[model samples]
Target: MSKPSRLWSIVDRRIHPPLLPLTTQDSQRLLDTIKNSFRAQLEKEHGLTDTIQATPSTTATNKVQSISNATTEPPRAFARPTDQHLHSILKNPLFSHQQQLKRQVVPASSVESDKMIFKQAVAKGLMNITRAHGFLLKVAGQKNTEPPVAKIENHGVGTLVLEWLRDSGQHRGLKWFSSSPEFGGLLIRFLLAEGHDELLLIWLDQLMTKEVSLGATGEWGITSMVFRELIKAKTLDPTLDDAYRTFLTGMNMLEGYSLSGKFFSTAWRELCWSTTVLAWKYPKVPAHLFEPFAASKLAKDPRDPRAHELPLAHLGLHHPEKPSVELALEWLRRHSFGYPAKMLLPAGSLEMARCLERLTSFGIDTAQHLLLSNQEEEAKGVMEYVKKITKILREKDHGLLPEAAP
Candidate 1:
């Protein structure tokens, strides 16, 4: 075999039948054909010209001449890039890869592109329910109040979610809402504020089937807000009664068993206004319902001018049949005030007498403290009541009278 044909011998052994071995002439012919074919293919596929300039050895040339009479084609010149051709090359994957590396140090385009594609996929309903839910949660967690598209886009998504729940009846979304009350509350408020009360009512009824929890701050629960919203519209009270009772039951389960207390610290003014509005409209809500909250820390201190003031005002001003005066007096007894006598004076002569009797039962020292703790006009009124009570008691010769009187 010729010197240039030696490389083809190895290839020939792999391809040829085991029984057939190539002669020197056959090997040289195969070598010439293979080299020319390979060069043509490299130029056609890679746009690279053949760089090798060495001529074939005389033995290889003579072998090629003896093998075939066909003339070999000369190698094409190297390609020069015109503007359009260079533009096309730049658009190819390799050139584009280099361009991308130059533009983005971290290659954020794919990440951003992925985000956009994901959003589009969700918007187009191309994603599965799990993917859709994840996307919705991401959107919900975003700080934006308005939907990314037109204002109606969120409404559409909201409707779609509800419809999905209706079809699947999974209860997964409800569980999510219960677990994430803040996000759930935002969604609910948005729905109500947008006048989607029917939809709000529907979701609320569905949600109420499961136990609802209070928020982190012990403020209004999801059920409570929905219940209150229904109450505000003066619609669906009958439908919401069970839910409201359930909500109140949950409220009573709080550490102090107090809804008023829950709302007082978080939103004192709203509590007062809500109490007034509700009490005025529905005067017959049993006083027992208010009992739990009345005894809470929020209501224990009569010194707190705002504490329990609304419920007291509501009971005293509107629901006189209820134990308004007794609650006020209990408030007084529970709290040691800077001016204890003043709080008693507001409950009228009957309650005032009962409160004094209570203090006196505790002992002369307690009664003396209640009176002596005040100054100004209050002290004068307390002293006179003490004197009158002492004279009456001494006349009756009751052991309740103290030996040392004011």
Candidate 2:
């Protein structure tokens, strides 16, 4: 047996010559002739009349004539219903409301238009330099009354805002991007330039509470820098303790550097930099936490596990930590670096003198050989720097270390 032919075959058949044109009057006349013939047949077969009354004399001829004329006449173009009028008549307000409720939607074309406008605005602002920040803020749905930089209080919204700021701020200068306030100003301007503050803070909280793994992205370095900067500035906020704890927790998660680790490639230098900053700002942190990081970053062997490091000797001493053997040794090594040579007679030289006294009291012989060992040149200058510190210590007669409290 064969399958039956589909009705669509006939329904979709193409016309060769297409439709024949008909004049309005001719069409009206043809329609009237067909209608009258049908009516006459119905009247003869069923005895139906145009009028309901069966009077011998026709009393409603005018009404019958008017009905006949209406069916026979062609509709005038000016009087015909437009598509808009037909749509209005066909659509009901209640039905439209129900449709909207079923699926709240914006037309895709409009959404695409909006996204394009946003991109163009961002590009223009970035290129102009002067208007970049203002343009970005406006495009992010910020109102005129709202500040350019805002603390998004709502967690979800704030996270989104931070993400936007991060991506947009990356291409702009540090000053323009850092102009906004966040975390009550504990943010490192450099990290802010990196545009990961929200996620950084989230990781900070998660790591602090041990709720998360050290899942990568070199978060350790940023956390370290943030804490170091905060300590250096003496910006004591109540939440800082928890934040610092998180940084320690994140540091512990690293099982030593490896090629396969997540975010490992980008995180090493950052973490190294953090270590340098922390070593400089040692007194503000716990000895136990600082010791391991300080030791690892200062490794002497080229093949040592933590040998790859960046130089950061430019940061000068300010509000120096109370003198200790470890602190003094690291200080001397850092100060000896040619890029940041110790000043001959600066304000903090007195603090350096005190550190030297403490180093001697603790017994300089105990200081590790690798403490001063960098490249050969760096190693050679170590004793000279140490002697200078010792001389200052003797001349100042500051033989005691400050109390062991931060």
Off by over 4 Å in 1: 1-121, 124-173, 207-273, 276-330, 337-406
Judging by TM-score against the true structure, name the best candidate.
1
Query: For residues 112-173, what per-residue lDDT tens digits would candidate 1 score against the true structure?
Result: 44444443443344554555445454544444353222122233344444444443444453
All models: lDDT? 0.42, 0.36
Error of 1 at 222 (Å): 6.7
Off by over 4 Å in 2: 1-198, 201-243, 256-283, 295-323, 326-406
Model 1 residue 99 lDDT score: 33
Q: Report lDDT (Cα) of residue 155, candidate 2.
A: 18
What lDDT tens digits, residue by residue, belong to model 2 across residues 277-305?
33332334454544443344332223333
**Candidate 1 C-alpha error for residue 378, in Å:** 6.1
